[model samples]
Target chain A: MKKPIRLINLGKTESWKTQAVYHALAEEMTDESPDTIIICQPDSPYLCLGYFQPFDSIFDRKNVELLNLPVYRRRIGGGATYLDENQLFYQFIFHHSRVPVALEKAYKTMLAAPVETLKSCGLDCNLRAVNEIEVNGKRVAGIGGGRINDAAVVVGNFLFDFDFEAMSTVWKAPWPGFRELAKDAVKERVYTLKQCAPNLRMRAVSDKLIELFPKYFNRPIVSGSLSQKEIMASQKTAQVLTDKIFLNDGNTDIPVQPRPLKISADVFIHNKKMFFKNKKINVSFRTDNDVITRVKVEGAVEIEKTIIGITIEEIEHILNSGSSTVLKDN
Target chain B: MSKKDYNFPADLHYDGKNHMWVKKENDNIVLVGIDAIGLDTLGDLAYITLKPEGTIVKKGEPIGTLEAAKMTGDIFAPVSGKISAVNAACVENPGIVNDDHYGKGWMVAIDASDWSTESTALISGEKLQPWIEAETHRMETQGFDA
Candidate 1:
């Protein structure tokens, strides 16, 4: 006997509603409530912070305020992200007993539907690492999962388009050149469905997900609306999501030194401005699994070629030693 | 690590449901932390936050939250009590919990209000080994390595 899962297809919603709907469902879920899958798109843009990611450490508050972007703190763990209408959100809320206890296995199970859906849309994509989905080495989706009370929740999106500039500009860069470096790195590593499958319609993608998810999970789907209690819970959860204190909560005082912007499971951008020979030198580089894969140095061109194949520790040693041999004739 | 290799210290009382261990510091004070099996299943932790000192929490309520890369789970209270102290070091650097889960990773000290009644629900003494064996078996059945 297959258990029936509720399908709540909210076509387009207020920005907060997109996040709050799933959160409310998870918070109020009990053994009696049916497992649910929610698909929705936000009508506007908002900045979402991870559950444990401190706001001050991740975002440029002044720029965020100037842009008038609403900031929300979701209970899921992940890096802070810029969300807008260009992405379709899929949120799954299941009782803890229904999903795999191991986080890795849980992600593989939940992401199977989206991976298959993207493939049907004429894109070659698969789940990478624990949760991210990628096509030809470029990430095509944003994913996050966590436990909220007794409910195990997984949320992700299909990117129709993304504003790389907005994402980079809003981040609190440790160095002046960091934003541009981040933007270029992200643009290189992320992809949109429209860019890959230009002929595919968003509705077709949604319909395919609706049809395929129940089959993948072996659960019959019953299209339904939120119960009155769930509606009230969502309204209240929205207030908590946008609360200033909640946004500012967590360890905000941690110093931002070598802030590494994670581009993928193996790619990270480390930016810092080092002082040597009474001259301030801007340093930006990308690391693939702790080894320097690329290097950009503002003060010395020679150091770039020298440090490309070295580990971060080796470069730090060369830079910190104030070795005139490396910095000479700059 | 295999199920038999995971540590379940003999002195601590374990909450099989939440995978937390409680150590009775005194009659009213009990120190709490997640067990080895729980940490093994969670993977490397990145961040942690606990209820502030002096906050009263009910049994099974969230005392704090722990996050790995993109997955977060709550640390539920093993016994109802007022939080006497929170481990600030663990909050600052959560990796220590991965390194020394039973030692420096201890999450909170609770001034328990209902020790006698709540203590009975916790598994300890002769029952600890059997309960852990069952739990590890259950996790393995759910596609997780012990």
Candidate 2:
């Protein structure tokens, strides 16, 4: 017989609490703890950083301060993202033994509920690659997971809506034009539930998830609230999540190349400035499934069209082939 | 007993539960890294962070974290020791861990405090093949290819 699971439906919570609740649960979990799922939405906006992402390298500190957004560094790994009430979060905290040993299998297992939930809402969505939920090649949900203490935590969001402008402004772009490029790339690649299903409500998505999770995991669900120990643990976890030292932990060294911003498993925006024959050139490009889909070149327009359909490896070969005139005739 | 898809080098000592391998550099100093099966299971690595040099860690405690595109997990120490040094190259270019996990991709160097006792727990030599086969079957059930 399968073990029973606990379900906590926190309709809305303070931004920090939404993140802290799951972290605390995972920290306090033991072998005997029931596998738990918490559904919640942050009452306000906040910036969440991946466990290994350096805050200074990924975010425009000035813009973040201007917006007065509280920054929280999650133990889970993924890129930094903006979160608000528009995105309903589903956090699953299970003992390591309960989840699949393989990360790919674990993701597919946990994400099955959300994917089915989206499908039930009359939207066509499926788990693409490992963890992404995409609708017609556009990503509809943001998912990330990792091991915390003895618990395997998978936290993902159902995007009722997304603030594209806030997302664009918060990131640290290499050049002034890079943000606009990123903004366009994300808008083109990410889809919201409202954009796909006009009448769907956040409550409906949460309710559907509650109904499907037990079926997927083959476990009976028991409606519950945070235990006294979990509440105390969350209070302490909140303090660490908001600390500045934790936010800047990943900034130990300056990155050599500005890392590409991954919009999805298959989409990324790369911005780099390189020297071509002593003339500095700014190159920004977008790749869809490893093939260059868009290109912007400040120093040479001819090379842009030539490299549009190629992979980054082919472009690097052309740039590093000891031929300064590679772009002259293109 | 090694499978065609994964490599379990005979020279290294493995903590099968944690998926870490240890190579003794000296009587007490050892280099540690994720085994081939662990690397394959993680898919492509995106980022990695190791504890700073000189941090004391107990056996089975986390020395750092490895982050792939979709998942992240702690890298546990196979034996109790102080982290003598961290592999800066792998931390800078995480892809190297996928490229050369046994050599330049080594995660950390530990100055072990109790190698004589702790080393016995790690699998090697005659015990290596059976451990790899068991782990392969275990992971395969969870959807790993091998």
Candidate 3:
């Protein structure tokens, strides 16, 4: 007989709380109960970037603020996602020995069940090489994970119910025009579960999940809650998440080499830096990349890159005008 | 229920503290970084700063930090001794803490002469289940339950 997988919905709590549960579950599987696969839902509306991405690029400053979001990153790696009530996250906790040793293959195989669920919703959702569920071409679901003793827990977010306007606003590329371009680029490629399954409300979507999950695993699905231990772990983790120095950090010395003609910002400093000229400004990049390093004013500030020249003008106006900190009155 | 499985590796060495083990590399120490259950439940790595090289930290002392985007975590020493080397790779890319938490992601290395005191808190392979369970229980009580 197959093992019964547990399904859980955080149901409108802070996004971090979802992570707290994941960690808690991982710990539980290892020691207390090694028999269950757990799923979760997160709270808040924000841009969640991949581990390899610099947050500034992943989050759209203007759009994020308009939504009054708490822009933050996650521990796993993958493309940034916009999560709101529009999305319901599902997580699977399992032992590695129980899974295939091949990381990439295992990730795809694990996500296949959800991919099918989304497909049933009517969208042309497709899984990609890295672990993204895309509609047409734009990603509707982002995935990532970690390993517990002989175990690997893979987690992902599905856009069952979400606000595209807010999502379009929160996520953007480093390139200013790229966002506008990407938006258009993504227009034909992406569609939400609501778009595909117009009749699927939050309740309906969840109900489908509750029913279909068991069939896929060929096992019973359990309705569960946080044990006393997991609650304590999340609380402890939450405290750590709130710390400033811990949440915002930087190690600028690790040389960053951006692509040619591209203006990549490394946030070890408070002033945002664009590769405008041969002269490198003495900007300190913050660890979070939300703030900037000081600007490196070189002799005449020659334009080594051409495109950013156009960007800096608009950037200057925004900085001079009222808004969020841009290179901070240097 | 918060599941805690020791899943500690058989090959890695330990430093005192609830943290687990890692093997020593040529000039750098490759640790599992943080245990699986440790970083995940804690949330994102908002900011993480390890003790700079040459800092003398006793075993189990606060060697550095592991911050989630929404939380803060202490990077406890994995060994008791003087800090001989560190993984600069992590200061640059903390996700390595997640990617290769135990392998390439090891945090720091200490040249320990006293294994009894510094290594006492560490566990490996089959021995890590109980503590993992304890930590999971701690998380469960704190709203980590789904």
DockQ of each: 0.44, 0.43, 0.07
Query: Any runs in candidate 3 off by more than 4 Å, and if so which?
Result: A1-3, A9-16, A27-29, A34-44, A47-66, A95-97, A122-125, A148-151, A161-164, A168-179, A185-189, A249-330, B1-51, B55-81, B87-110, B114-146
lDDT of 2 by residue, B14-60 (tens): 99778889999976999999998888768889878788899999999
TM-score of each: 0.90, 0.92, 0.56
Indicate the DockQ of the complex predicted as candidate 2. 0.43
The lDDT of model 2 is: 0.84
lDDT per residue (tens digit) for residues A122-143 in model 2 = 7778898888899766898889
Interface RMSD of 2: 4.8
CAPRI tier of model 1: acceptable
Chain B TM per candidate, please?
0.93, 0.93, 0.73
lDDT of 1 by residue, A73-166 (tens): 8998877889999999999999887887777888888888999998887677888888889987689988989989989999999899998888
Compared with the true structure, all predictions reach lDDT values of 0.84, 0.84, 0.53
Q: lDDT, candidate 1, residue A11?
A: 89
Q: For model 3, give the RMSD to the true fold.
A: 11.5
The C-alpha stretches of model 2 lying farther than 4 A from their native spots are: A253-257, A276-281, A299-303, A318-330, B1-5, B142-146
> In candidate 3, residue A71 scores what lDDT?
43
